[model samples]
Target: MRVVTATNAVKDERQAGGLVVEVIETTSLGDRSYLVSDGEVAVVIDPQRDVDRVIAVAGRLGVRIALVLDTHVHNDYVSGGLELARLTGAEYGLAAADEVPFERRPLADGDVVQLSPRMRVRALATPGHTFHHLSYALEGAEGPVGVFTGGSLLFGTTGRTDLLGQQHSEELARHQHASAQKLASMLPDGAQIWPTHGFGSFCSATQATGDSATLGEQKWINPALTLAEGDFVEQTLAGLDAYPAYYAHMGVQNTTGPEPLDLREPVRAEPEELRSRLDHGEWVVDLRSRKAYVVSHLAGTVSLGLDGPMVTWLGWMIDWGAPITLLGESREEVGAAQRELARIGIDKFAGAAAGTPEELAADRSQLRSTPTATFSDLAAALAGDSDGFPAPEVVLDVRTNKEFAASHITGAVHIPLYELKDRLGEAPAGAVWVHCGSGYRATAATSLLEAAGRTVVLVDDTFDAAAAAGVPMTEPGESSSSS
Candidate 1:
């Protein structure tokens, strides 16, 4: 794979003659997917659940989709391969070892399929990302042209092995090294690399230099090929980091096969119907500005700002398949959120409501306001603790564990936003003051806290204000950390 490091490395489009390669970038996840075609026929590799974009591209290219090839059942996001395959009369192919309830072409190592007169693909058993993953090497009559390195050997290194669970992490890491070596041995030095996960994808074991890289260059940088297997495994395993809670569900769903997406527009709900569903305990997602949401919103609604990366937080925080009602300032905003939700196959939008607060919430008592506090306000609260420890007024830092360790308000409870849904008990019993590096994640945390009926004070200000607020910051390996 070629490592294109420029921030704009991935353009809206990239092509390769009859073998067209379109980069489908999911910025929220920092992941990349692709559509490869031989002019007459096309194949989508590791696609997201939203199939409309791929379909539109196929339509514009006048190429019929002949196959939907998944490198493996993904762990991070729902697979659209099965659904998209079924929709376009294309065969869905997965490694033979990936046992699922659905019907699909079973691919094995050394299996070569001629997609067209000039296009051919060979499946190589590159199992490290997942035990059943397959990497397809493509040849377009010009000898070995490009290789889809799925989660095998990424832009700079191989895929992480720990996503399977702790019990299998080390073993898988060893296997990952071997797989990367195996692919490098077979592919030509000049082969073009097209990876499914690149840029800042969590699936990557090491920091990816870029997406557009060569097999020859990879041999120089890829530890699996350059270092001893023992050393390679150790480094890769050490580089492993945390993934999201929703990831555990993806593989299972892809193996069993996801349901076809209902592309029909979400039904618009009247204010009365919206209120009734809220009374029934259904979810209402507010896709408005953070400022607007904290000002006046339904008592139990979760606010994920539409102006930001909306879908990832929703999938991370909300339960899958649970009915959700979307509320936006306008129909346009609701539609944007709906499209974002569709990326992860969340089609259970129960209804949509768009209007001013006074109009939507006719009962003003149902309207709840979240009060905000700056870093200085929190510092003062902590200074007054008689026990010399802040408790009753807790400073809940909801940034990533890495960020929290770098610098944070002393005695602040560290809970990354993604894990809040499962680890809500770790939050303080005292009044919670939620904040992140900035207010982006704090807004998400507020919704979760409010949903669970916990009294919370939203710390919706910048993290840099900590110094001015007298909140002491510390680097890693410091005594200030409370875990």
Candidate 2:
């Protein structure tokens, strides 16, 4: 794994023998798109919907992009493979089973694509990640340099099979096991695994082992290798949880062929326009820091922080077709947010405004304070002895069941952040105190609740901090950790 540093993480570079695989890592999605070239012709794999970055890289490298290949119709973000191919005059290739409603080179198992005389790419039908996934094996003059495993086999575990829906989960899990076995059996010990997901992707069923792992090392340590087919399926299915709501939209759009992206500049909106849009029920997502958001913000405006996983939550909590407005601390921050938001196929940017809450608000009345409480503050409130406490309407825990089950504050409501949208009614009304392992999901929860006209308090503290603060809590092994 040889790294070539350039501008930043967005357009990083890596080497595989004679191949230069430019890594476009979308930090928000925890996914990577590769622009691989054997110094003559380039091929892009699992590209983000924003195709300009890939194009820019290709232009810099001075290699003609001959092909655009997708591992599968992605669920996490819109596929830019088709759009990039269209823009570059490159031949686009996807799995035949994906049934994409347009013409392209239908890639199949064992199909060899010659990059050059000495360099070639062989397609391997690695199903289980959406049932139409393909892994491309790269062969250079020095035997096999690497395998682009996509979602079939990852750094530690394989991509979760349950994203297609509940009915197909079990069957897909079985396919995933067989697919991992196949890759391990066919590929040599030294083959470098370049996965599209699993660095920090939720698509990974479990935590990442490390950045990258070899086929030989994975064979010994990967949990997928140790389990039988049925047991593997059962274990995988059990670990699955709620995915983003926008995921339901990606697969169908890919099959029907996505509309070409509009990468034009976002227009600026005035404070008066912001108020008018909000009055008309359009979402104005503030991409400010969480601390800034909690300290002071527009009364009804929701905070989707500029840092961390903006697209996933933006897609999940907001309607895709709905008109949206963005607010950031500066024009540059707004530009950054717009670029990331576009990856999820959100192109409808009505306008954007860059200002603090004071400047953005038409009147001081539109500004409000959303307090951030720590676990200690939460404990004091639950005890009903803290001064000016209103009996703490709900101590909401927004972490996954895995984290929640580990150790949670007593009397806290358990609702995973991903599922909070549809289950809003299940949450108690008024003064809802929210906390996750850290404050990211808690901020998300806060914004969600605040958008729905409920008062929210972010538990902006670590789980261990809460435990150390002597907040009434239950240990992991306790029969009941419920408050």
Give the range where candidate 1 is weakest over 10 consecutive residues by summed lDDT. 1-10
| Candidate with best TM-score | 2
Candidates in order have lDDT scores of 0.78, 0.81
lDDT of 1: 0.78
lDDT by residue (tens digit), candidate 1, 102-221: 889999999887888777789999888888789998877676777888888888777778888878878887788888888778988877788877566677776788647778988887
Clash totals for all models, in order?
Answer: 11, 0
The best candidate in terms of lDDT: 2
Which tens-of-lDDT digit does each residue in 1-483 have in candidate 2?
A: 343422354333344566776777787888888877767788888888888888888888898999889998888888898888888899999987766568899989999888777577889988897787899998887767779988988977889988887898888888899998998888898887888998777788776677666799888877677788888888888887667788888878787888887766678888888888877767888898788888988866767797777777788877668888889989888888877877777877888888898999887887877777788887787777545545577788888888887777776789888788778899977688889887977887887787788877788888879877768787776654343
Candidate no. 1 TM-score: 0.84
- Give the clashing pairs for model 2: none
* Shift of residue 416 alpha carbon in model 2, Å: 2.7
